[model samples]
Target: MAGEELKPSTVISLADAMQAYSAGRYAEAEDIGCRIAAVHPNDPAVWNLLGVVARMTGRQPEAVACYRRGIAVAPDYAALWSNLGNALKDLKRCEAAIVCHRRALELEPDVATSLHNLGVALTAAGRDGEALHAYDAALAIEPANENVIWDRALSRLRLGDYAGGWQDYEARFGRDELPKRDLPGMRWNGGPYAGKTLLVAAEQGLGDGIWVARYLKRVKALGGEMIVECREPSRALLASMGVADRIILQGEPLPAVDFHIPQCSLPGVFTPDEAAIPTEPYITADPQERARLAPIIAAAAGERLKVGIVWGGSGTYASRADRDAKLAYFLAHFNIPGVQLFSLQKGPQEEELKALPAAPVVHLTPHTADMFETAAAVAELDLVIMTDTSVAHLAGALGKPVWVLLCRVPHWMWQYGRSDCAWYPSMRLFRQRTWGDWTGAFDEAAAALQMLVLQRSGKLLTV
Candidate 1:
């Protein structure tokens, strides 16, 4: 009813634009939407479509402008308000987005999208309990909403309800964002695959692959041959650690297997209880690789205590920006008298090292290309100080002493409020006392690092 009374040419153009957007031709849709907006400046529908296309194309600011323009034209449009809220949420304006979502809900009380958006905003604002209630209300309206179900899973897990959490987490497989694998076998249902091959396909990030590989040994002991499918970067390291009987890269042609399971689902099958989590390091560096890199690292260290530092994770990660610590923070805080810091950071964030603040921390990331090399380099280090990144998982997997700086509400794997990680014996968690407050975490880490440095230098006896 919104754009129905327009001219015939305008109607056809609007239809074309909507079809293009629905078909995933965002660029074409954006061009058409802009043309329509220019010709019919009063049409809120055209502006709304432009906003959607802009948001889909990673133009959040443009999307916000378009949504604002649409709101100006049709101030009472509930859909426009909800859409604007989503864009604002993406821009990390959680409180403002929440306000928009609430206004949308006031206009259209039964709108599931508004409810779901409200849930997401609340979750980002660290109100997970209220977020769950919002999600529940949305689910009541639309029971099979995958997005709401997946988000609800995260909220449940954050609250430390593993039993309730894992069940809902299964909804992630159906979410469109995650790449789905279509293997030619039955899904593993926590049963023994005696004398058969079980393909453990990789899902999610490289760190998740390494984290879940711990359960592969258990899968092996179940009287079955296990084939672990992982990313190319992880294959060598995981193979070296003997995570499975056979290791294969993700894009390789699948070998015949009786059943298959995603790596992330391992926790649901094996260790559902938090207390029963395996603490021993299941991944180890190759002996030859470790031997080869040990001298190179020692020479770089000279006479000081070697500490590997990773200030950032992959930028593609959803929470990378949130998890990242300022390189300057580490440079200023980690200046222990007898300690020599080495950067284990890689990717685009590596460029930040050029601005190192008078601290002579060596950058070892160039020497470590893949996880195998990272594990080898980590093995040679005295300690690792890192944010919530793959390097932390790698250091922990190698049984190296790692101090992991966590966000106030860290990933579900870290669990609720414990300083020591149950999965990695050598890893210590430094959590933020307040949300988005890395300073407090850094202060605690600095004190612990000072004690460690003193112990290393024989100035203190206890660690």
Candidate 2:
């Protein structure tokens, strides 16, 4: 041996712990770490490693405890503080988590990762401006930090800083962590469409397609030949944006063009600000589609005023996908007397509607041919109420009379702490004050519908 020394038993155990952790043997890692911790109670590294293992294994409380123990042992480890903050955030202790992140940033400023985490915690706490600053701080150190830039853009959007937000919103494409687009066999760079035609395809969820399809009009305004390739659910709606030169299902073939842009890239290309929101509902039911569905809607809508309702969206979230509002959940608590209800809901929820008391209501969801058909049906309605679904986006995009019911932690488009959606001038938001409790939202919706009903009858009720 170059240097004669006794190998520390605790250090050996720690090395074993690291190996186990790296091998994905979480239980083995936990045991090895605990053994070292028992022998070297003063070693903060052991505790920190244990915390990481705990966090990895979904024992968030244990992770928090381990982090705290590490911090107590060595209060100066900025990384330990940051890890603790992340654990607290997983526990929904956002305020405490931000404090820990801030402390870590203070002790070692300009750390990009911690700064990004700090922005996330701030945004979760509904502190948008501070979150924006945190993200900006991270960007100041690493300008192309994609996630930080994305967060900053969202924060800008929520604060109604339209120009800056849309300008930055373009950063989402081709980034790591974003879903890979299933190229419908062709792609383009969005070059001038003067003599060339490009097929703009949609790569994300239907809501995204709906929101960004507003840019298709800009493309049309640019005097280019363009066709919108969208999710099957969005064909009609995209067609109605008054811009797409053609509308087809995702992956459908189209006339060649100079370049192509994803539907969601419209904001990036058009630089949409509040002034450029394309607020008017340009998509609607064509005369034939409306006429075809008139009998069905009329029969279902009957003497009572019709309210097309959807309380959930297609699953686009990773965590808590199960929290989607089931129509039965809301209907169980609802007893709207004069408001004849129709379920404009699509996908899996349509199957469940067969079990509800819908004799007074109608379900034309399955019959809808496209977004245009849906919009036509929606246009026939006195109002549309829905969960954070593409239906909401369509109604909102169309500037139809829409009432959106959102989960407490809704999609970013609703913006932070918002009761109104600027994207759709006629849309109103009713958010869950607490997660999974639609009672409050339903109560508000019921009241609003009552007011709407009263208004229809020439009675003005003050809110």
Top TM-score prediction, candidate number: 1
Name the regions of candidate 1 deviating beyond 4 angstroms.
1-17, 23-43, 69-75, 325-329, 354-359, 407-409, 415-418, 431-440, 455-463
Give the local distance difference test score of model 1.
0.85
What TM-score goes with each of the models? 0.86, 0.82
Instruction: Give lDDT: candidate 1, residue 203.
Output: 87
Tell me model 2's lDDT, rounded to 2 decimals. 0.75
lDDT (Cα, tens digit) per residue for candidate 2, span 245-282: 77778665654555666777676565545665667765
| Backbone clashes, each candidate | 0, 16
Report the C-alpha lDDT of model 1 over 186-266, residue by residue, as the tens digit: 899878889888999888888988888778778888857888999988888887865588888888899988999888898
Pick by lDDT: which candidate is best? 1
Residues forming the 10-long window of minimal summed lDDT in candidate 1: 1-10
lDDT (C-alpha, whole model) for all candidates: 0.85, 0.75
Candidate 2, which segments miss by more than 4 Å at Cα?
A: 1-43, 53-59, 179-192, 236-257, 319-323, 326-329, 332-334, 348-362, 369-372, 407-412, 416-419, 432-440, 457-463
